[model samples]
Target: MQDFREAYQSTAVEVQENDIQDNEVELASPWQRIGAVLINSLITMVLYVPLFVGTAMMGDSNGESGVMWIGISAVLLLAWGIYQAILMSKTGQSLGKKLLGIKVVTLEGDNPGFVGTVLLREIVYNIILTVLGMIPFLGVLISIGAAIALLVMIFLDGNNRRTLQDMLAKTLVVKA
Candidate 1:
């Protein structure tokens, strides 16, 4: 043991230092992401409130009126999706994330492009969700399972702090 310790002590070692800068990034906490998502969801709901009310008021028990209401809702949803995509693509921060001083970036700590932020992070997952939601009871179960799995990943990802969407886009949410 003494000989081993002597040998180990005699060995020289080097430690590499990181280049610290003013723009050093910090990993976002799970709570921060959750809060941001909730706040953003509220904002989205607020934007859709008027349309929802109008559609509700105009909707009739008749199947004919139902189709129109569905069409209107679809248009509004599409518009909102586009708006969110544009904001995320340009700033790497949604309104909630901006307000919270958190932003999304690539794994290497650079801005994720429109394709990464919008297409991979948002649209792809939503498309899956929408498709699954169209199915019957099994779909609901699967959707719930997927959501739970995402939450688990977010919580278990340690210092990396990535969610499923982040994993998919090779992105990270970090303090700005």
Candidate 2:
């Protein structure tokens, strides 16, 4: 047991050093990316269950409950941001990123001075998309376009990773 522990730590140090030696970013595989997304989404869904109920409580067949829905949504988003941020800090990756073997690092400025590129690239862009989705018929078109653009960015990335938001934030989805 003692020998195995030493081996694991030694291996970890070697990998970290190699990352520095490479001089360029090392990214994770695409399958890991999908896994991480699935994991994170499942966690988020469970967290938002009560929030969903609250939103529904304020609505009915007639329509939404107006400001209440908006407030519930805001709280839900805030909760999501905090949760993702905390997870990113501790793991250097969210559940999805961990599954994908990717960690978020800022290639550019942490202009907002937030930890974990996932906070900005994932949480912030989500907000923008959500806000855009609130519009009329145009909102739907914009949402679809934005989603397509994000996917295209990922496809065009060097290793089938890094969506538009990731590129914009100068972050990488790298192997753990």
Candidate 3:
């Protein structure tokens, strides 16, 4: 009985050590997160350049060309969103995050999958912000304030470094 107990205790310690090693992750710094966001915003703006150029060249007098441009822009935006979602689901890194050498991962350090990346992190917060911005006189201000609050949370959360979206999605942005 004494020998069996010793064997069990040793095995338990080894399992605990392995678990700790498996779950360990280096969190991305606040600056890295900010840089990634900036890169993403720049990429988004660049993607829309074609629409802007087409609109400028066509000069929609009859509103017909304006509708076409809007359609094209919508398609382009949808494609971009899909591309980002795919990357996030598979690798936990959007284009900007990949470039910045950081990635979003579950608490267990696995890829966040589609629901976490698309629904919780991206769609839900965006919908809330859009609704806030659509309100009356204080709408845009409230939206901007909420965005700032979310950004500030990253700085405040020293241990986990999670923003609101990261909390909601049960994810962390970590060094790749």
lDDT of each: 0.74, 0.65, 0.81
lDDT per residue as tens, model 1, 1-176:
99998776555211100211124667777788888889989977766665665566565565556556567767877887787778899989887888888889876667887988888899897898779877887888878888887777767745366777887887878887
lDDT over C-alpha atoms for residue 115 of model 1: 85
| Per-model TM-score versus the true fold | 0.71, 0.59, 0.77
* Model 1 whole-model lDDT (C-alpha atoms): 0.74
Q: On residues 53-95, what C-alpha lDDT tens digit does candidate 3 reach at each position?
A: 6677576564666667767877888899899989988998889
Best by TM-score: 3
What lDDT is obtained when candidate 3 is compared to the true structure?
0.81
Model 1 scores a TM of 0.71
Candidate 3 wrong stretches, greater than 4 Å:
1-22, 60-75
Candidate 3: residue pairs that collide:
none
lDDT of 2 by residue, 1-176 (tens): 99999999899856654554365655565566667778887877776665676566656663455446656767877877787777776656765776566776644312223544655676778888899899988899999998777555555544336676765565666665
Candidate 1: Cα lDDT at 2: 100
